[model samples]
Target: MKQIGVALWLLFLPFVLFTAQAQESKPLSVDVLWQIERIGSPQISPSGEYIVAPVTRYDMDTDKGESQLWLFSPDGKTQRPLTAEGLRASQPTFSPDGQALAFISKRHKDDVGQVYILPMNQPGEATRLTSVPTGAYGIKWVGEHIYFISKVWPGKNWDDIAEQVKHEANSHVSAHQWNALPYAQFDHWLDENREAHVFRIPATGGEVQAVTQPLNIQLPRSSQSASSYDIDPSERYIALVSDSLNDGVSPNNDIFLAEIGATEATNMTPQNRGNDYNPMFSPDGQVLAFQRQLITGFYADTSNLVVYDLNKKTEKVLTEDWDRSVRGLVWTANSRGLFGTIDDAATSRVYAINARNGKVKALTGETNFSGLSISNNGILVGTNDSFLHPAQLVKIDTRNGSTTRLDTFNDALLADVELGTYESVTYKGYNGDDIQMWVHYPPGFDKSKKYPLFLLIHGGPHGAISNGFHYRWNAQTFASWGYVTAWHNFHGSSGFGQEFTDSINPDWVTAPYADTIAAANWFAEKDWIDADRMVAGGGSYGGYLSTILLGKEHPFNALLIHAPVYNMYSQMSADFAVHAERFGHYWEKPEIYRDISPHYYADKFNTPALIIHGQKDLRVPVGQSFELFRTLQSRGVDSRLIYYPDENHWILKPNNSVYWYQQVRNWVEQYATPGAQ
Candidate 1:
């Protein structure tokens, strides 16, 4: 008997060792999260021969991050960095012939990001392509010219613009003057005086020629990027997104089509009432595609794809019958199909839409994919990420939906990190409607033992909690601390359909609040959950929901709210009003504002809460956090307020983000003990 036992132990030694090794792995930490290299969207060559993407690495000591352009081959064999380390490089664009690459970089004595071209076929250093004093961005290379957008004085030349920039820097006056409605965006104040226009220079270097300047039309005042404009393959026409009304307060974005050097442009979508933007010219130069939304005030309105024929001068709405909004669009080589990364259900999937028939077919599944780029041969490259991993550059198979990872970024960092498990679940919510949610269990989770629950409310009121790896409010990170974290796709969450997303407008409290309570009750019924120990919170819209919970009777011991819109009346001071234009102004809809605002229910505030906000949060305004904090204190509830002076709406800086995570962990652990008991 003793000899037989020794022989059996030897047979199972390898299996026992592997299990021990898996059990010894550590859970995800803030430090490990920072250590992972973040990869940007892939920019594939015209023939699908080379792929270049920006890889960013953070230094905890410097409290900064540096990005470098990295090169990858589609066969998954070659991986190397194109740009030098410790320099800023982004906006990678390949030449039409795929012989060279152009990107924005601020190196050496450059004051701002400028266009730099690197030869892909030859062993040569990157050559400075532009010397624009106003700097260059939103770059695209077409035919024999390189196009870029620059904010400049409309009538001033390059030298004059440079002189003006120098004068403004040397001047002591810090005040800004604005005469328009969109005086500020999310974080920074906008200069209403400067106009953003497209400019192009010869590939061999020459005088810059204005593309949109001659038309006397400026890009949208609030924001402009590469997606704001497109140059046709023939280089004969340019399509740009500009405000049709030119009234900043309720500006309607529309597409303007013009000949490359024409003095006047035609408004293509003059009949549409809502916003229309993201003009993309098909490779064949026959069609122009753009996204359109019908509602003026709702930022999260469903965006449908529309295409216009250049020859026929007719327009068609391709995605009018579809329920999902299309984003990150890329035209295929044949120009017969358009590839878009869509927010479908709870995942961000890549879909191929037949441009001719308006039929949509999902090309990727499960995980989130974005930054789609296609080659002339129909090859697709993009970034794929999930809850357990950061984004990796991938070459997606257009036919079978399989992906060949082009870059091995963050693989070593995550090798020893035992990330938690998560799954999609459905529960009875408001009106007994099924609400889909993501529930994450801690590493080494045991069903026999009871664990604490941390319910996370997602913001966006329209932003659905997708399956992409979240950096700011990572559910897996919360689960790593030994608590089961969940993100509920409650009422008003997008991706389910247009009707479900618009269900909670005007009255924001009823459905979402009931769904949240139902989520807690659902968890309470689970045998593995400790019914007495529960916490919930979110940011932006999520923060608003958490504040609502503070005033209502719920199954939560603590709440964590960040950058919340506490008082609806005072939210008028925000950069954008929530329900003013489309629904009605607060004065016009007094009862709706009064009932839905979280501040009105402060009399019932009793739950301990942690309120976090940034001084530069123009979206929700820093005052919202203060109002919630004061109300909690006035009600004699246990509460804490954390303020980030150098941050914006998000804790972007590395050290600040680490400190934020630490503080949140400290706050949550103070009330509800983590781990199973």
Candidate 2:
């Protein structure tokens, strides 16, 4: 029963592609991927009467996109747009009384993103609150104050900060200097002198007060967003997550608690030291809840829920044995329980945790839920999506775990298109574990005839190809070209368990390589698959693994490596270097680097590879892809490098994304002819 590299559910697809050769709807195409409107997270009002969500659309002619806030009733009967067509509004948070909403947007002459308050009950225009020349974001409305996060020069006032910003822009000094770690993030460089801190201004307009600066705790060096800090009900206490270590690789983000006007902050979880973040105070203002992880360098570490009693000065781990990282934290009105989201077996679902006994229960299933917001009455709102469906706003009934669709976003657009069929099947992978793999069959597929296989390796190594729909990497879109596309949640993929995720730790290559190769071999043996006409591809860590395949004997006819980390030494130039924290630098441990780095295997490279990289990709550094492409060319291996100068780690622009899809489609089809034979 523990057959290696073989699928156990081949017999489940007994039907011959389920009505093949019949007149089918149009296949999912690149145009459809671009045309479909993107639905952001939903923010339900405190009163539970209204929900505001952001809907984004792109114009091909202008090569631009705009996001607008849309208003919907809980009953799904009334739907309307709140902002004007051209205005782009995001991060909507309703006021305590539900009469106003605070969001971030730059309208008209605003140079950067500023806080805008839109009245919920009246028809007046959204008014700009902060004119801090440097801009403001991560907005929260609590008790007569509007708190926001802004990056500003320490010990500088608004006018001085404005001058500093302008001087930095106008200065002829094109050089940047950093004395500490984490000098840059994904797409932009982080200014070493400027610190990101939380500040609060009066709700009706008053002088701004720096909340975190006087306490002397800077936010994480790389970046800080809305999840970095939380303010209690009465604004007496503030809980924030800050990194204690200067070493960029090991993220030692610890939770700190301080009274609003206190001189010093207390490090609550300083003893364990791995990573603790997303601190939120309970509704009663007595308990502080946050997530904690025990391992550094391993980002997929299971985060246990920690609850601290503000009054009793006691702490406890609520979800110590749950085996899932809790995120999207929100307190149920009474503070008796909480509803959070987690990734389970490659699917995201909401789960409720009892504060009294630390018990956990699933509240929603199957579909991936995100942007979670809850009302005082237990009404929950979030965006629900799956492999076959795009994100849609929905309200979940907490009692019975049933969902009610609140918005019909893309019904008409998807009605005429035929998405391919897919199934969640398990295959024997590394260490005899039942690895979850998602296989997508082309529309109008005929199982009687053999079809090419398009194998896709997911990045994150920890980031699994979940049940949710994706814009960049879609299995159905690949399958539309007469090939069966599959994604194997290999050993290192998250949502499986702690041990499974940590399988490819310091080595960072062996288990995932074995699992992916096993996945390819598994599909090749299928009666309906053409083993000879197979292609494989991936980005980031996926690209890194594909690079490894190039150095070894593999079944794939070709490979697509995008934004990869090909050389361990050059990877140090990246903002976040992989494995440096765990195995030390390549100079300190040359043997480990030589054994695992893909550049060391260039001598054995023979596979035809399509290398894709974005110049602005700070995570992997585009140089890695360039190195791989050069190696392939020098070895006389058929390879091509596609580079995007304007994109970041992901191809975000509509035109750029469309072009990328077409390029990938052409490359795959040219090497492995599509369609059944």
Candidate 3:
């Protein structure tokens, strides 16, 4: 009798824990989204024994985020923070010997971001390395030197720059003048006089030396980061990105090679009119690998992998005819191949490209993989996540593509949170091509009942909503609102073939517009979806498309357009002039702008809309949103506009994001209440 009672108690324990877990697993909310930890890409040591990554946490009440560098063993044991509270470090790069880690941080409250070094094997705190007043970014550790990029005033030293920055700050100069095309980037104003160039410092602590300043070529003004340059293992030759054209309206980034101390740099591929970037040297330092794009204005052009033979002084387009774009470019131990993440049919996969024949083979499938770090032994480590799962540290086997989770971050937090279910489906879209779409259902969804639909249109105009966990503008959070949320990788979305991506280039309407409406009609046919109560919304280009939907006859009851490019003529005031080079200026090609510009079709905007924009949004100016709101008002259409004074491109502040979501919910509820009937 006693043995039987003990067995029954043990059996009952499992059920009790399962019920407790179920009770804790509540629906995902904005609060939960903010509470979850964000893990960045892991940086594997040269020896492949350790991995370091930045982990960010947000405080809802404080409405602030804090990032700290954390170290983890490859086997998923012994996780610890390398830096303590109040200190934020980013872009961690391990030295060749794997003895020290170099990162960028602003240790002093008033100090600009500078390079700092922390000993990997020692128990000391991080020591500041560079004191550049303009701040150092895109840090890299190679051989015996630490390389970084900084935008500095010409003919000025460190002290002079510091004084200049202080003077500029103290001087209430409210005017900004630009003589050239690119006066601003995505969020910040670019100083036309200040040049962004690569500089180097000895790893053992020495004076900073300018590498590209004397070359008389400035890095691309609007876009330049760590990927723009790479130092060879020999530290003899440096490969950097620059453009011959100073027009600035067109980005003509090309790879330029220069000796370590030479004053001259030669353009490697001046023949290619498009963009070339992400310079990486082979392990043996004989071959240089970079990504090449074909189109200049179309940012979504397929990136082909190109390898430049140093001895031969010739270039080969490896992925010439391939349909997908290469991301996170990395070299193998033998320099025989490259590894990176690629988007394919609404999924991000890890692929290995054979350097010899350009044969592409996917290593991992389904889940979105990012922050790829490869070592000499062919060990690849990155952060992988799915729609239902948050990012986790992972190790990828370059040979078989098997993945091993290296860290169990947010597992407990997620285990206690009930998440909705999602799946990838197909539908015939524009051009009769098979289009992929992802549908997210509520946590306690029931197919027997009818639920309101929240159609989510992705931006990038070319980027896909892949199988990944997203904190901002999350589909799951929207699904938690008791609606069937979906993301359609319509025409012009990448990951499909090149033809499918470039199909909507100049038109920017016809195909994607048709596909979006088709997706709506497809979901309307489903018995479980309440077609009449559907709401559609998006950000950036997504907002642009939703604006297009407003002019067309759509089933959506309400629309949410955030940071939309409404007027083509007004968009020229943005960071990059849209369609000026591709379709010619509006004056030159009036029909192209007249036909597609949303403002031109304002007479048909009858649907209610909620408009949102940020003052710092340079990609799609906030003025665009103002123009849209005014048009809706002039037409007497029901509309509301929300403006952010401090935020940029996206709602980044925790409080601001929460408020944005709340207001959006209110707007959706006012127009089309969510829930299943």
Instruction: Quote each prediction's TM-score.
Output: 0.97, 0.95, 0.96
- In order, candidate lDDTs are 0.92, 0.87, 0.89
Listed per model in order, the count of residue pairs whose N, CA or C atoms clash below 3 Å is: 0, 0, 0
lDDT of 2 by residue, 1-677 (tens): 65532454454344434544234456778778888888898888888988999999988888899999999988999789998899888889888888999999989998889888889897799988888878898888888889999998999999999898888879999998988777889998887888889999987777899999999988887888888999998989999989876456577899999999887999998887678998988888989999888876767889889999998999999888777788777889899999887888898989999987789999887879888899877689888898888898888888867898988878988887887899988988877778899999998788999999999998987988888998899888899888999999999888888888888877777888888888988898889999999999899889999999998878998998889889988888998767766667778888888888999888999999999999899998888888888889999999999999998899998899889989999899989999999
Q: Pairing residues by index, what is the TM-score of model 2? A: 0.95
Residue-by-residue lDDT tens digits, candidate 3, 321-386: 788898887888788988888988788899999987899998888789999997766678988999
Clashing pairs in 3: none
| Model 1 Cα lDDT, one tens digit per residue, 1-677 | 99999999999999999999888787788888889899998899998899999999999999999999999998999899999998899999999999999999999999988899999999999989899888899999999999999999877888889999999989999999977688888999888879999999888788889999999999999899999999999899999999989987788899999999899999999999899999999999999999999988887789999999999988999999999998999999888989999999989999999998789999888999999999998889999999888898888999878998887788877888988899999999999899999999998899999999999999888989888888888888999998999999999998998989999987899999999999999999999999998999999999999999988999899999999989999999888788998888888989889899999899999999999999998998999999889888988999999999988899899999999999999999998999999
Highest lDDT among the candidates is held by which one? 1
Model 3 misplaced stretches (Cα beyond 4 Å) = 1-23
- lDDT ranking, high to low: 1, 3, 2
Worst 10 residues of 1 by lDDT: 405-414
Residue 133 of candidate 2: its Cα lDDT?
75
